[model samples]
Target chain A: DAGITQSPRHKVTETGTPVTLRCHQTENHRYMYWYRQDPGHGLRLIHYSYGVKDTDKGEVSDGYSVSRSKTEDFLLTLESATSSQTSVYFCAISESFRAEGYTFGSGTRLTVV
Target chain B: AQSVTQLDSQVPVFEEAPVELRCNYSSSVSVYLFWYVQYPNQGLQLLLKYLSGSTLVKGINGFEAEFNKSQTSFHLRKPSVHISDTAEYFCAVWNTGNQFYFGTGTSLTVIP
Candidate 1:
Protein backbone atom coordinates (compact mmCIF):
# COMPACT_ATOMS: atom_id res chain seq x y z
CA ASP A 1 0.00 0.00 0.00
CA ALA A 2 1.84 3.05 1.25
CA GLY A 3 5.59 3.48 1.75
CA ILE A 4 6.39 0.49 -0.49
CA THR A 5 7.19 0.74 -4.19
CA GLN A 6 7.92 -1.88 -6.88
CA SER A 7 9.68 -1.14 -10.11
CA PRO A 8 8.77 -2.22 -13.62
CA ARG A 9 5.02 -2.14 -13.05
CA HIS A 10 4.77 -4.04 -16.31
CA LYS A 11 7.43 -5.92 -18.25
CA VAL A 12 7.59 -8.34 -21.14
CA THR A 13 10.70 -10.41 -21.72
CA GLU A 14 11.63 -13.27 -23.96
CA THR A 15 12.11 -16.69 -22.49
CA GLY A 16 15.63 -17.50 -21.23
CA THR A 17 16.34 -13.81 -20.55
CA PRO A 18 17.21 -12.62 -17.10
CA VAL A 19 14.57 -10.61 -15.22
CA THR A 20 14.85 -8.79 -11.97
CA LEU A 21 12.05 -7.03 -10.08
CA ARG A 22 12.90 -4.41 -7.52
CA CYS A 23 11.10 -3.60 -4.28
CA HIS A 24 11.88 -0.45 -2.33
CA GLN A 25 10.34 0.70 0.90
CA THR A 26 10.55 4.04 2.73
CA GLU A 27 9.03 2.73 5.96
CA ASN A 28 12.34 1.35 7.18
CA HIS A 29 10.63 -1.85 8.11
CA ARG A 30 12.94 -4.75 8.88
CA TYR A 31 10.77 -7.43 7.33
CA MET A 32 10.36 -7.53 3.57
CA TYR A 33 8.83 -10.25 1.40
CA TRP A 34 8.31 -11.14 -2.23
CA TYR A 35 5.27 -13.09 -3.45
CA ARG A 36 3.93 -14.11 -6.78
CA GLN A 37 0.19 -14.20 -7.52
CA ASP A 38 -1.11 -16.76 -9.90
CA PRO A 39 -4.52 -18.11 -10.79
CA GLY A 40 -5.71 -20.93 -8.50
CA HIS A 41 -2.58 -20.47 -6.41
CA GLY A 42 -3.37 -17.17 -4.72
CA LEU A 43 -0.13 -15.67 -3.38
CA ARG A 44 2.96 -17.82 -2.93
CA LEU A 45 5.98 -16.46 -1.13
CA ILE A 46 9.21 -16.58 -3.10
CA HIS A 47 11.60 -15.18 -0.56
CA TYR A 48 11.90 -12.82 2.39
CA SER A 49 14.48 -10.83 4.26
CA TYR A 50 14.53 -10.20 7.96
CA GLY A 51 17.35 -7.67 7.79
CA VAL A 52 20.01 -6.40 5.49
CA LYS A 53 21.90 -9.32 3.94
CA ASP A 54 19.72 -11.86 5.75
CA THR A 55 17.40 -13.70 3.42
CA ASP A 56 15.44 -16.94 3.39
CA LYS A 57 13.53 -18.99 0.87
CA GLY A 58 9.79 -19.60 0.81
CA GLU A 59 7.59 -22.40 -0.43
CA VAL A 60 8.15 -21.61 -4.10
CA SER A 61 11.81 -20.69 -4.45
CA ASP A 62 12.88 -23.09 -7.12
CA GLY A 63 13.10 -20.63 -10.03
CA TYR A 64 13.60 -17.44 -8.06
CA SER A 65 16.33 -15.75 -6.09
CA VAL A 66 16.39 -12.69 -3.83
CA SER A 67 18.95 -10.30 -2.39
CA ARG A 68 18.66 -7.62 0.25
CA SER A 69 21.84 -5.57 0.69
CA LYS A 70 20.06 -2.63 2.35
CA THR A 71 17.08 -2.25 4.60
CA GLU A 72 15.18 -0.30 1.99
CA ASP A 73 15.66 -2.50 -1.01
CA PHE A 74 14.84 -6.17 -1.81
CA LEU A 75 15.45 -7.50 -5.27
CA LEU A 76 13.95 -10.66 -6.83
CA THR A 77 15.73 -12.18 -9.79
CA LEU A 78 14.83 -14.87 -12.26
CA GLU A 79 18.05 -16.35 -13.60
CA SER A 80 16.32 -17.30 -16.81
CA ALA A 81 12.78 -16.19 -17.51
CA THR A 82 10.34 -18.90 -18.52
CA SER A 83 6.70 -18.96 -19.53
CA SER A 84 5.83 -20.37 -16.12
CA GLN A 85 7.41 -17.34 -14.46
CA THR A 86 4.73 -15.02 -15.79
CA SER A 87 2.71 -13.57 -12.94
CA VAL A 88 2.17 -10.51 -10.78
CA TYR A 89 4.85 -9.99 -8.16
CA PHE A 90 4.10 -8.06 -4.99
CA CYS A 91 6.37 -6.71 -2.28
CA ALA A 92 5.34 -6.37 1.34
CA ILE A 93 6.92 -4.67 4.36
CA SER A 94 6.30 -5.01 8.07
CA GLU A 95 7.98 -3.89 11.22
CA SER A 96 7.66 -7.32 12.72
CA PHE A 97 5.95 -10.59 12.04
CA ARG A 98 3.57 -9.91 14.89
CA ALA A 99 2.98 -6.41 13.64
CA GLU A 100 -0.60 -5.36 12.95
CA GLY A 101 -0.46 -5.91 9.21
CA TYR A 102 1.80 -5.91 6.17
CA THR A 103 1.90 -3.05 3.72
CA PHE A 104 2.18 -4.08 0.08
CA GLY A 105 3.40 -2.38 -3.06
CA SER A 106 1.30 -1.99 -6.17
CA GLY A 107 2.99 -4.97 -7.94
CA THR A 108 4.91 -5.81 -11.07
CA ARG A 109 3.20 -7.66 -13.91
CA LEU A 110 5.73 -9.76 -15.78
CA THR A 111 5.05 -11.64 -18.97
CA VAL A 112 7.40 -14.11 -20.60
CA VAL A 113 7.15 -14.34 -24.31
CA ALA B 1 4.14 -23.45 8.42
CA GLN B 2 0.43 -22.63 8.09
CA SER B 3 -1.81 -23.32 5.15
CA VAL B 4 -5.04 -21.62 4.08
CA THR B 5 -7.80 -23.05 1.97
CA GLN B 6 -10.60 -21.09 0.35
CA LEU B 7 -13.58 -23.27 -0.51
CA ASP B 8 -14.90 -21.33 -3.45
CA SER B 9 -13.22 -19.98 -6.55
CA GLN B 10 -16.16 -17.76 -7.48
CA VAL B 11 -19.30 -16.54 -5.79
CA PRO B 12 -22.02 -14.64 -7.63
CA VAL B 13 -24.65 -12.87 -5.60
CA PHE B 14 -27.40 -10.37 -6.20
CA GLU B 15 -27.11 -6.83 -4.90
CA GLU B 16 -28.15 -6.29 -1.28
CA ALA B 17 -27.93 -10.02 -0.58
CA PRO B 18 -25.96 -11.56 2.19
CA VAL B 19 -22.83 -13.53 1.31
CA GLU B 20 -20.32 -15.73 2.97
CA LEU B 21 -16.88 -16.78 1.73
CA ARG B 22 -15.41 -19.82 3.38
CA CYS B 23 -11.81 -20.17 4.60
CA ASN B 24 -10.16 -23.02 6.46
CA TYR B 25 -6.64 -23.10 7.85
CA SER B 26 -4.29 -25.78 9.12
CA SER B 27 -1.56 -25.13 11.65
CA SER B 28 -0.05 -26.91 14.58
CA VAL B 29 0.18 -23.85 16.79
CA SER B 30 -1.82 -20.69 17.24
CA VAL B 31 -2.14 -18.40 14.24
CA TYR B 32 -3.64 -15.11 13.14
CA LEU B 33 -6.26 -14.94 10.43
CA PHE B 34 -6.96 -12.23 7.85
CA TRP B 35 -9.14 -11.43 4.92
CA TYR B 36 -8.14 -9.14 2.06
CA VAL B 37 -9.96 -7.74 -0.91
CA GLN B 38 -8.44 -6.76 -4.23
CA TYR B 39 -10.23 -4.59 -6.70
CA PRO B 40 -9.57 -4.88 -10.38
CA ASN B 41 -6.05 -3.75 -11.29
CA GLN B 42 -5.39 -2.70 -7.69
CA GLY B 43 -3.36 -3.98 -4.77
CA LEU B 44 -4.98 -5.92 -1.95
CA GLN B 45 -6.57 -4.04 0.95
CA LEU B 46 -7.13 -5.50 4.38
CA LEU B 47 -10.74 -6.39 5.07
CA LEU B 48 -10.38 -7.68 8.63
CA LYS B 49 -8.26 -9.76 10.99
CA TYR B 50 -8.71 -12.07 13.96
CA LEU B 51 -5.86 -12.29 16.44
CA SER B 52 -7.48 -13.15 19.76
CA GLY B 53 -10.09 -12.28 22.40
CA SER B 54 -12.85 -12.31 19.85
CA THR B 55 -14.39 -14.96 17.70
CA LEU B 56 -16.31 -12.45 15.60
CA VAL B 57 -14.25 -9.78 13.85
CA LYS B 58 -15.63 -6.77 12.03
CA GLY B 59 -13.85 -5.01 9.21
CA ILE B 60 -14.13 -2.19 6.70
CA ASN B 61 -17.02 -1.92 4.22
CA GLY B 62 -19.44 -3.79 6.44
CA PHE B 63 -17.46 -7.00 6.28
CA GLU B 64 -17.11 -9.39 9.19
CA ALA B 65 -15.49 -12.76 9.90
CA GLU B 66 -15.94 -15.43 12.50
CA PHE B 67 -13.10 -17.56 13.77
CA ASN B 68 -14.32 -21.03 14.70
CA LYS B 69 -11.59 -22.83 16.49
CA SER B 70 -13.47 -26.08 16.77
CA GLN B 71 -13.83 -26.33 13.04
CA THR B 72 -10.56 -24.64 12.24
CA SER B 73 -12.35 -22.23 9.99
CA PHE B 74 -12.54 -18.48 9.46
CA HIS B 75 -15.40 -17.42 7.26
CA LEU B 76 -16.10 -13.88 6.00
CA ARG B 77 -19.61 -12.50 5.86
CA LYS B 78 -21.43 -9.38 4.79
CA PRO B 79 -25.02 -8.68 5.71
CA SER B 80 -25.84 -6.70 2.64
CA VAL B 81 -23.46 -6.27 -0.24
CA HIS B 82 -23.23 -3.60 -2.92
CA ILE B 83 -21.82 -3.51 -6.39
CA SER B 84 -18.66 -1.95 -5.06
CA ASP B 85 -18.08 -5.04 -2.98
CA THR B 86 -17.43 -7.14 -6.04
CA ALA B 87 -13.79 -8.07 -5.90
CA GLU B 88 -11.37 -10.91 -5.35
CA TYR B 89 -11.14 -12.06 -1.73
CA PHE B 90 -8.22 -13.89 -0.18
CA CYS B 91 -7.90 -15.70 3.14
CA ALA B 92 -4.55 -15.84 4.86
CA VAL B 93 -2.98 -17.24 8.03
CA TRP B 94 0.19 -16.13 9.79
CA ASN B 95 2.53 -18.92 10.81
CA THR B 96 4.75 -19.13 13.85
CA GLY B 97 7.58 -17.51 11.87
CA ASN B 98 5.26 -14.59 11.07
CA GLN B 99 5.09 -15.73 7.51
CA PHE B 100 1.74 -15.52 5.78
CA TYR B 101 0.13 -18.33 3.81
CA PHE B 102 -2.72 -17.55 1.44
CA GLY B 103 -5.44 -19.57 -0.24
CA THR B 104 -6.62 -19.65 -3.81
CA GLY B 105 -8.67 -16.46 -4.19
CA THR B 106 -12.45 -16.37 -4.44
CA SER B 107 -13.82 -13.84 -6.89
CA LEU B 108 -17.12 -12.29 -5.87
CA THR B 109 -19.36 -10.79 -8.51
CA VAL B 110 -22.27 -8.62 -7.47
CA ILE B 111 -25.08 -8.60 -9.98
CA PRO B 112 -28.13 -6.46 -10.44
Candidate 2:
Protein backbone atom coordinates (compact mmCIF):
# COMPACT_ATOMS: atom_id res chain seq x y z
CA ASP A 1 0.00 0.00 0.00
CA ALA A 2 2.73 2.44 0.83
CA GLY A 3 5.17 2.68 -2.05
CA ILE A 4 4.34 -0.60 -3.76
CA THR A 5 2.09 -0.72 -6.85
CA GLN A 6 0.91 -3.74 -8.80
CA SER A 7 0.04 -3.43 -12.44
CA PRO A 8 -3.01 -4.91 -14.18
CA ARG A 9 -5.43 -4.99 -11.29
CA HIS A 10 -7.34 -7.71 -13.18
CA LYS A 11 -6.74 -9.80 -16.28
CA VAL A 12 -8.24 -12.75 -18.10
CA THR A 13 -6.34 -14.86 -20.57
CA GLU A 14 -6.71 -18.23 -22.21
CA THR A 15 -4.73 -21.27 -21.17
CA GLY A 16 -1.34 -21.95 -22.84
CA THR A 17 -0.82 -18.22 -23.07
CA PRO A 18 1.88 -16.11 -21.51
CA VAL A 19 1.26 -13.34 -19.00
CA THR A 20 3.38 -10.95 -17.05
CA LEU A 21 2.57 -9.08 -13.86
CA ARG A 22 4.58 -6.16 -12.60
CA CYS A 23 5.37 -4.96 -9.09
CA HIS A 24 6.91 -1.52 -8.70
CA GLN A 25 8.16 -0.07 -5.47
CA THR A 26 9.26 3.45 -4.69
CA GLU A 27 10.93 2.55 -1.42
CA ASN A 28 14.04 1.04 -3.00
CA HIS A 29 13.70 -2.03 -0.83
CA ARG A 30 16.60 -4.44 -1.28
CA TYR A 31 14.43 -7.52 -1.20
CA MET A 32 11.37 -8.17 -3.43
CA TYR A 33 9.06 -11.15 -3.48
CA TRP A 34 6.22 -12.63 -5.51
CA TYR A 35 3.44 -14.53 -3.78
CA ARG A 36 0.28 -16.20 -5.00
CA GLN A 37 -2.94 -16.41 -3.02
CA ASP A 38 -5.14 -19.41 -3.55
CA PRO A 39 -8.35 -20.58 -1.90
CA GLY A 40 -6.80 -23.16 0.45
CA HIS A 41 -3.11 -22.33 0.22
CA GLY A 42 -3.24 -18.89 1.73
CA LEU A 43 -0.20 -17.10 0.28
CA ARG A 44 2.70 -19.05 -1.16
CA LEU A 45 5.98 -17.59 -2.24
CA ILE A 46 6.63 -17.89 -5.95
CA HIS A 47 9.90 -16.06 -6.48
CA TYR A 48 12.13 -13.57 -4.75
CA SER A 49 15.05 -11.30 -5.62
CA TYR A 50 17.80 -10.22 -3.31
CA GLY A 51 19.40 -7.76 -5.70
CA VAL A 52 19.56 -6.80 -9.33
CA LYS A 53 20.00 -9.83 -11.58
CA ASP A 54 19.67 -12.10 -8.58
CA THR A 55 16.52 -14.19 -8.02
CA ASP A 56 15.47 -17.50 -6.55
CA LYS A 57 12.57 -19.89 -6.94
CA GLY A 58 9.81 -20.35 -4.38
CA GLU A 59 7.82 -23.38 -3.33
CA VAL A 60 5.53 -23.05 -6.36
CA SER A 61 7.92 -21.84 -9.01
CA ASP A 62 7.37 -24.48 -11.66
CA GLY A 63 5.27 -22.34 -14.03
CA TYR A 64 6.58 -18.93 -13.08
CA SER A 65 9.77 -16.95 -13.56
CA VAL A 66 10.90 -13.64 -12.13
CA SER A 67 13.40 -10.93 -13.07
CA ARG A 68 14.81 -7.90 -11.33
CA SER A 69 16.66 -5.60 -13.68
CA LYS A 70 16.57 -2.62 -11.40
CA THR A 71 15.91 -1.58 -7.85
CA GLU A 72 12.21 -0.73 -8.09
CA ASP A 73 10.69 -3.27 -10.47
CA PHE A 74 10.12 -7.01 -10.15
CA LEU A 75 8.42 -8.87 -12.97
CA LEU A 76 6.55 -12.18 -12.68
CA THR A 77 6.01 -14.03 -15.91
CA LEU A 78 3.92 -17.10 -16.52
CA GLU A 79 5.55 -18.74 -19.50
CA SER A 80 2.54 -20.93 -20.18
CA ALA A 81 -0.59 -20.07 -18.23
CA THR A 82 -2.86 -22.83 -17.00
CA SER A 83 -6.02 -23.23 -15.02
CA SER A 84 -4.00 -23.86 -11.90
CA GLN A 85 -2.08 -20.63 -12.49
CA THR A 86 -5.19 -18.54 -12.12
CA SER A 87 -4.97 -16.84 -8.77
CA VAL A 88 -4.37 -13.54 -7.06
CA TYR A 89 -0.72 -12.51 -7.15
CA PHE A 90 0.76 -10.23 -4.58
CA CYS A 91 4.05 -8.29 -4.55
CA ALA A 92 5.86 -7.57 -1.35
CA ILE A 93 9.01 -5.55 -0.59
CA SER A 94 11.32 -5.14 2.35
CA GLU A 95 14.52 -3.29 3.06
CA SER A 96 16.33 -6.50 3.79
CA PHE A 97 15.87 -10.20 4.20
CA ARG A 98 15.56 -9.75 7.97
CA ALA A 99 12.93 -7.06 7.77
CA GLU A 100 10.38 -7.38 10.52
CA GLY A 101 7.67 -7.60 7.93
CA TYR A 102 6.97 -6.64 4.35
CA THR A 103 4.89 -4.01 2.61
CA PHE A 104 2.54 -5.60 0.11
CA GLY A 105 0.99 -4.13 -3.00
CA SER A 106 -2.74 -4.11 -3.62
CA GLY A 107 -2.36 -7.32 -5.72
CA THR A 108 -3.16 -8.43 -9.27
CA ARG A 109 -6.07 -10.76 -9.90
CA LEU A 110 -5.56 -12.94 -12.96
CA THR A 111 -7.97 -15.39 -14.54
CA VAL A 112 -7.14 -18.06 -17.09
CA VAL A 113 -9.72 -19.71 -19.27
CA ALA B 1 13.40 -25.61 7.63
CA GLN B 2 10.53 -23.47 9.00
CA SER B 3 6.77 -23.91 8.68
CA VAL B 4 3.57 -22.51 10.12
CA THR B 5 0.26 -24.10 11.09
CA GLN B 6 -3.05 -22.28 11.19
CA LEU B 7 -4.94 -25.19 12.76
CA ASP B 8 -8.29 -23.66 11.74
CA SER B 9 -9.56 -23.19 8.25
CA GLN B 10 -12.63 -21.23 9.16
CA VAL B 11 -14.01 -19.56 12.26
CA PRO B 12 -17.55 -18.26 12.61
CA VAL B 13 -18.73 -15.93 15.31
CA PHE B 14 -21.49 -13.41 15.77
CA GLU B 15 -20.84 -9.73 15.80
CA GLU B 16 -19.36 -8.41 19.05
CA ALA B 17 -18.23 -11.89 19.96
CA PRO B 18 -14.78 -12.83 21.04
CA VAL B 19 -12.64 -15.00 18.80
CA GLU B 20 -9.22 -16.53 18.77
CA LEU B 21 -7.13 -17.83 15.87
CA ARG B 22 -4.41 -20.29 16.61
CA CYS B 23 -0.99 -20.40 14.91
CA ASN B 24 1.98 -22.63 15.60
CA TYR B 25 5.47 -23.01 14.24
CA SER B 26 7.43 -26.23 13.92
CA SER B 27 10.27 -26.74 16.39
CA SER B 28 11.29 -23.11 16.28
CA VAL B 29 13.15 -22.03 19.37
CA SER B 30 13.08 -18.41 18.25
CA VAL B 31 11.01 -16.59 15.63
CA TYR B 32 9.50 -13.29 14.57
CA LEU B 33 5.73 -13.60 14.53
CA PHE B 34 3.30 -11.43 12.63
CA TRP B 35 -0.43 -11.24 12.00
CA TYR B 36 -1.94 -9.76 8.85
CA VAL B 37 -5.57 -9.16 7.90
CA GLN B 38 -6.97 -9.15 4.39
CA TYR B 39 -10.36 -7.53 3.98
CA PRO B 40 -12.42 -8.44 0.95
CA ASN B 41 -10.47 -7.36 -2.15
CA GLN B 42 -7.94 -5.24 -0.32
CA GLY B 43 -4.33 -6.22 0.02
CA LEU B 44 -3.06 -7.58 3.30
CA GLN B 45 -2.40 -5.18 6.16
CA LEU B 46 -0.19 -5.95 9.11
CA LEU B 47 -2.20 -6.14 12.31
CA LEU B 48 0.59 -6.76 14.78
CA LYS B 49 4.02 -8.29 15.20
CA TYR B 50 6.06 -9.90 17.97
CA LEU B 51 9.77 -9.28 17.56
CA SER B 52 10.89 -9.21 21.15
CA GLY B 53 9.70 -8.41 24.63
CA SER B 54 6.07 -8.26 25.65
CA THR B 55 4.62 -11.65 24.83
CA LEU B 56 1.31 -9.89 24.26
CA VAL B 57 1.50 -7.66 21.21
CA LYS B 58 -1.37 -5.37 20.33
CA GLY B 59 -2.02 -4.26 16.80
CA ILE B 60 -4.47 -2.17 14.84
CA ASN B 61 -8.20 -2.92 14.60
CA GLY B 62 -8.30 -4.11 18.18
CA PHE B 63 -6.37 -7.26 17.42
CA GLU B 64 -3.72 -8.79 19.67
CA ALA B 65 -1.51 -11.87 19.67
CA GLU B 66 0.54 -13.73 22.25
CA PHE B 67 3.83 -15.43 21.43
CA ASN B 68 4.58 -18.52 23.48
CA LYS B 69 8.06 -19.83 22.94
CA SER B 70 7.53 -22.95 25.01
CA GLN B 71 4.61 -23.95 22.89
CA THR B 72 5.92 -22.46 19.63
CA SER B 73 2.55 -20.78 19.23
CA PHE B 74 1.40 -17.27 18.47
CA HIS B 75 -2.35 -17.04 18.83
CA LEU B 76 -4.32 -13.96 17.80
CA ARG B 77 -7.12 -12.69 20.02
CA LYS B 78 -9.78 -10.05 19.94
CA PRO B 79 -12.18 -9.48 22.79
CA SER B 80 -15.00 -8.39 20.49
CA VAL B 81 -15.18 -8.83 16.75
CA HIS B 82 -17.27 -6.84 14.34
CA ILE B 83 -18.66 -7.64 10.95
CA SER B 84 -15.81 -5.65 9.49
CA ASP B 85 -13.43 -8.11 11.05
CA THR B 86 -14.87 -10.84 8.88
CA ALA B 87 -11.82 -11.37 6.73
CA GLU B 88 -8.86 -13.63 6.16
CA TYR B 89 -6.20 -13.61 8.86
CA PHE B 90 -2.73 -14.92 8.21
CA CYS B 91 0.03 -15.80 10.63
CA ALA B 92 3.59 -15.53 9.41
CA VAL B 93 7.09 -16.16 10.73
CA TRP B 94 10.57 -15.29 9.52
CA ASN B 95 12.86 -18.25 9.79
CA THR B 96 16.59 -18.30 10.38
CA GLY B 97 17.14 -18.09 6.66
CA ASN B 98 15.18 -14.83 6.57
CA GLN B 99 12.53 -16.32 4.33
CA PHE B 100 8.91 -15.78 5.27
CA TYR B 101 6.45 -18.58 5.75
CA PHE B 102 2.68 -18.18 6.07
CA GLY B 103 -0.05 -20.32 7.52
CA THR B 104 -2.94 -21.67 5.51
CA GLY B 105 -5.02 -18.80 6.78
CA THR B 106 -8.18 -18.66 8.91
CA SER B 107 -11.29 -17.14 7.43
CA LEU B 108 -13.34 -15.34 10.03
CA THR B 109 -17.02 -14.94 9.25
CA VAL B 110 -18.80 -12.49 11.50
CA ILE B 111 -22.46 -13.33 11.35
CA PRO B 112 -24.73 -10.39 11.80
Off by over 4 Å in 2: none
DockQ of 2: 0.74
Off by over 4 Å in 1: none
Kindly list the per-residue Cα lDDT of model 2 for residues A1-113, writing each as its tens digit.
98999999999999999999999999988999999999877899999999999999998999999999999999999999999999999999989787475898999999999
lDDT of 2 at A9: 97
Model 1 Cα lDDT, one tens digit per residue, B40-65: 87778889998898899999999999
Alpha-carbon interface RMSD for all candidates, in angstroms: 1.5, 1.1
Provide a comma-separated list of chain B TM-scores, one per candidate. Answer: 0.97, 0.96
Model 2 lDDT at residue B35: 93
Model 1, span A1-107: residue lDDT tens: 77898998999999999999999999999999999999999999899899999999988999899999999999999999999999999998889866355888889
lDDT of 1 at A81: 96
Q: Going through the candidates in order, what is the number of backbone clashes in each?
A: 1, 0
Q: What local distance difference test score does each model get?
A: 0.92, 0.92
CAPRI-style grade of the A/B interface in model 1: medium
lDDT tens string, model 2, B42-77?
A: 788999999999999999989999999989999999
